[model samples]
Target: MDDLIVKTVTKLIIPFIQLYGIFVILHGHLSPGGGFAGGAIIGASFILLTLAFGIEYTKSILSAKVTERVEIGGVIWYIFIGLIGIAISGVFLGNRVAGFPMGTFGSVISGGMISLITIGIGLKVASTMISLFHHIIEED
Candidate 1:
């Protein structure tokens, strides 16, 4: 049954995928993965959850409206943070001028802007994907 497929995928794949997404978000500053990749992975996780749990369960976790707000708010938060760099650092997204103490490479919270942006992007992406799921599954 489709339900079994969805449930199994949700239970098994989501955790690892989400962990990988977090890794992507966290490792962004040191390596290739960044906000975009992290965000996308979070989004994928949500989609899988929705498919497995069904609309009602999904809504329990995140309503479509809430997801929309989260997406918008994340973007706003990201913009605001980036703007701080602009006003002080003299360039957009210029986090360096803000004087964030860059920690050891590959450590969580090591890269300041990279971490902040990754969080913002993850929320934005998760919410966006949830919204998309609501649009598709809510009708069913």
Candidate 2:
């Protein structure tokens, strides 16, 4: 952790890792990767940071309160998306029925509410993984 090489390598790779994770999340519907996979990658980056640095250092970067809020917010966002379906179409998770504009096929915005749902899923998964890791570290 104190080594210059480790610090340098971690600092360099962390951004790339996060970028890839976001890419995966954003392109989930178009490609094979989805919210879960992308979120795991992002969470792993944080775990990697914790390993390369120390718990204290990682804590400063992602405080417990912030993590909790993010995790809860993700779920709330998902629920809200579903609620939109109910409110609009009288059905849960209604896509076309909810009148969400589905863009051109195979395009980024083509899936109506799918992209937003996936984003919520990705956020929830990433926060959960980080939270679990943090809890485990704390227990040690």
Best by lDDT: 2
Error in Å for residue 41 of model 1: 1.5
Alpha-carbon runs more than 4 Å astray in model 1: none
**Shift of residue 22 alpha carbon in model 1, Å:** 1.3
**Residue-wise C-alpha lDDT for candidate 2, range 36-86, written one tens digit per residue:** 999999999999999889888989999988889999999999999999999
Q: Could you list the CA RMSD of all candidates, in the order they appear?
A: 2.4, 1.0
**TM-scores for all predictions:** 0.80, 0.96
Model 2 TM-score, 2 decimals: 0.96
Task: Write down the lDDT that model 2 would get.
Answer: 0.92
- Find the 10 residues in a row with the least total lDDT in model 2: 131-140
In order, candidate lDDTs are: 0.78, 0.92
1-140 per-residue lDDT for model 1 (tens digits): 25776677569877899899988887777788887888888888877776667677778877777888888999899899878887887778876678767888666768667788778887787677768767876673
Deviation of model 1 at 44, angstroms? 1.3
